[model samples]
Target: MLQLTDVAKSYPTPQGPLFVLDGIDLRLAPGESLALMGESGSGKSTLLHLAAGLDTPDRGEIVLGARALSSLDEAGRADLRRQRLGLVFQQFHLVPSLSVLDNLTLQARLADREDRDWTHHLIERLGLAGLEGRYPEQLSGGQQQRLAIGRALAPRPELLLADEPTGNLDEGAADQVLDLLRALIGESDCALLMVTHSARVAAPLDRCVHLHHGRLADRTP
Candidate 1:
C-alpha cells in the first residue's frame, strides 16, 4: 500500500545541507506491519514523515497505492492524507478542550465522513466508552493515548503511520497501548509503518528495518 523509491531529504545547516534520509527504497503491502528502528539522528522519523506525506522529500518519490505523493500539490496531499492516512504520534496530540468522544471523531468530521456508529464502536473497542466525556487533561497517559488511537482509527484509513507511539507511556501502559494498536490494525486490515527505538516495541511487527547515517541498513534485531 505504501512505497518509497530513492527517497532523499536534506536540510540546510550552518555548515551546509545535511542529509537526513538518502535513497530509501521500501514497500509495505496491504495489512502488513513494519517497524523502523534507529538511534538519534538516524533519520527514522524523517522517513516516517516522508512516507506519511507530512513532509516531502527533496528528491525521489513516495507512492501510496497508485498515487505518487510528489505528483500532488499541497492541497491534494492534504486531501489524500485525510482520506487514506491515519497518524499517531509519540506525544498524544489530543485537543485539550475537547472531550474524548469529540477528539475521536474530529478527523472523521473534518473529512465530512463521520459515521456515528463507527465512531461509537471505536470508542468502545478502545476502552473509552464510559470515559468519553472526560477531557484529555483529566485522563491518564494510557487513556489519552488510547483516545488518540481511537481518533486515528475512526476514519478507517487505508494506511497507518505511527511515530514513537509508545514513547511517552510507562512500561505497563506502553504494552497495553501497543497491543491494542496491533489488534486494531489487524482487525481493520490497515497497513502500518511505525518508527521506534525500542526493540521490545518493534519485535512484534512483521518486519523490522534499521537506519544508520540516513541510509537503510541491511540489519534487523
Candidate 2:
C-alpha cells in the first residue's frame, strides 16, 4: 500500500541542480512484492529513501496506505517510519554489542510492540534458531543478514523497504536469503519493495520496474 506521484528530487551541484528523480510514479499493494532495478546513479536508492521518509522529495507526493508523507512533520514522519516501516540495507547494520536475539528484537522493542512468540517464529523462519546468543561479528555474513531481516520484520511492519538486500553474499547464499525473505514476506502479508540491480534478484518478485535517468519504465523481466 504505497504510492508515488510526479515525484521529483534534485540536489545542488557546482554546475547546477542535478536531478536524481524526475516525475517518477509507482505503486505497490499490500502483500505484493516489487523489484526496483536501476544502474548506478539512476536514483533507485533515492526513490527508496523518499518512500521510506528518510529523505523528503523536492516535489511530489508519497502516500503510504492512507497517509501522505508530505503531510507529516519531521517528528510525525519519524514516528510513522518507526511504527509502519521496516528497512533492510546492503550492510547489515546490526548492533555489535547486542546478541542475535537482542538485535532481532531491537526494532520491535523500540516500536513498543515486542512479541516474544512472533520474534521466536521469525528466528526459526530465518534459520537463526541456534545462534540467539551470538553477536554480529561472531556470525557469518548470511547469518548476520538474516538477523537484520529478522530485526526489521519483528514489529510486523506494514511495508518493508529493502535496498540491495543480498548484495554481499555469493550466488547460492543470495538465492537462499531471497527465498527466505520471500517466504516470510508472504506469510506476514507485508508489502515488499526491493531495490536491486540484478535481473535475477528481480525475477522472483510479482512485478519489476527499471529506473533510468530519474524516470521509471515497466520491466517484464
Q: Residue-pair clashes per candidate, as listed?
A: 0, 0
Model 1 residue 156 lDDT score: 87
TM-score of each: 0.96, 0.98
Off by over 4 Å in 2: none
lDDT of each candidate versus the true structure? 0.90, 0.93
- In candidate 2 the C-alpha lDDT for residue 175 amounts to 89
Best by lDDT: 2
| lDDT at 52, model 1 | 78
* Superposed model 1: Cα runs more than 4 Å off: none
lDDT of 1 at 167: 91
